[model samples]
Target: MHATKGTPDATRFLELLRLSVSLVLIIFAQITITGFVGFFVVFLPFLSSSYSPGSLLTGMKFLIAGFAFALPWLGYWWMMYSLSGNGRIRGFFLLLLTSYLALIFICMQIDPVYNPEAMIPGSARESTFLVCMAMSAVILFPFYSLGVYIFVLRPVKRPRKRYRFLLLCLLFAVAGLVLLPFLWHSAPIVYPGLLSFPE
Candidate 1:
């Protein structure tokens, strides 16, 4: 049998999953916005044509990134634990780090198959983007409930009112997965920019 929801093991496991997904999103969003230095993306733009930073700048970048990324996450957890009136447990942060690294390794090992060229008729970039999105919609179908639990229900301060407003989120997430194949043909129409990118 599964551990009850409020039990130590259950709570810890839920937090681990939430932290893993949130951190993965954070790392990727930072990469999208800043393109380097990973997580907080605090690295300075290249001062030399070689597209690299000096040693001092590199060190400074890492220092800033570490604090920038760590502070907010720590603050959120601090607030959470404080609200729950629980003593801080330090080891899970290390475990979270290990989980994030494992996720990175797993993602790197995935060789994405691209098949949108015929349907979307766009640059490799957009097609690849769409393919990844479609795959996510399909593969994550089962875990949408887990996502809702992590992102929505668990965060609610009121236990009784949790999931009241989030039923649609779960439905839409599942619907996308179910409809992706039928929707693939009209993707170009749906995403006007899909055809705008130069091949």
Candidate 2:
């Protein structure tokens, strides 16, 4: 019996797998922390009332839902970040956009009680989801771009012409708005019943 040596491709694959697992763990931690804070904020008023138990349970449900809804985009951002190399400004911007989108989707899905209609296939629900996604992209793009410009790009290299950068950002904003509807239609909803709790 002899041990077989791993090929370069296999070794690279294993390295990627390890990196992915680590990234996932980090993302989960972030989501858990965020969820806990959100739950506390939303459920604080119910603490002194008879509805405390129910509120606590609902808050827990929201926490779980938030984690589920955020996982996909978080993973997407992590992968993008890992591949970004020196051009981290673009990557960070992408991360911000995805995070904002995740928050928007989670907020839209929240209810005192679970709604099964969100998961059911119907034209109305689909349209609503599409609209929400597009609206979120539209709302977040400018903020995301500005944050990138201020925090990421400005420190690295000052632009010779600030107006040109602003113009570019505006162009990107317009492009994002134009493409959002198509993206909304094409993108599959990752966690349709994310707000639901188990029976």
Best by TM-score: 2
Q: lDDT (0-100) at residue 54 of candidate 1?
A: 25
lDDT, residue 20, model 2: 59
Give the runs in model 2 whose Cα sits over 4 Å from its true position: 1-11, 43-109, 113-150, 158-199
Q: Which residue window of length 10 is worst by lDDT in model 2?
A: 46-55
> Considering every candidate listed, which one attains the maximal lDDT?
2
lDDT of each: 0.42, 0.44
**RMSD of candidate 2 to the true fold?**
12.6
Q: Candidate 2, 132: how far from true, in Å? A: 13
lDDT of 2 by residue, 88-195 (tens): 534344445445555455455543334456674324333333333334443644454454445434444555424544554455445544544444444335334423
TM-score, predicted candidate 2 vs. hidden true structure: 0.31
Local accuracy of candidate 1 as per-residue lDDT tens digits, 164-199: 324534455345445444444454554444455554
**Looking at candidate 2, what is the lDDT of residue 165?**
46
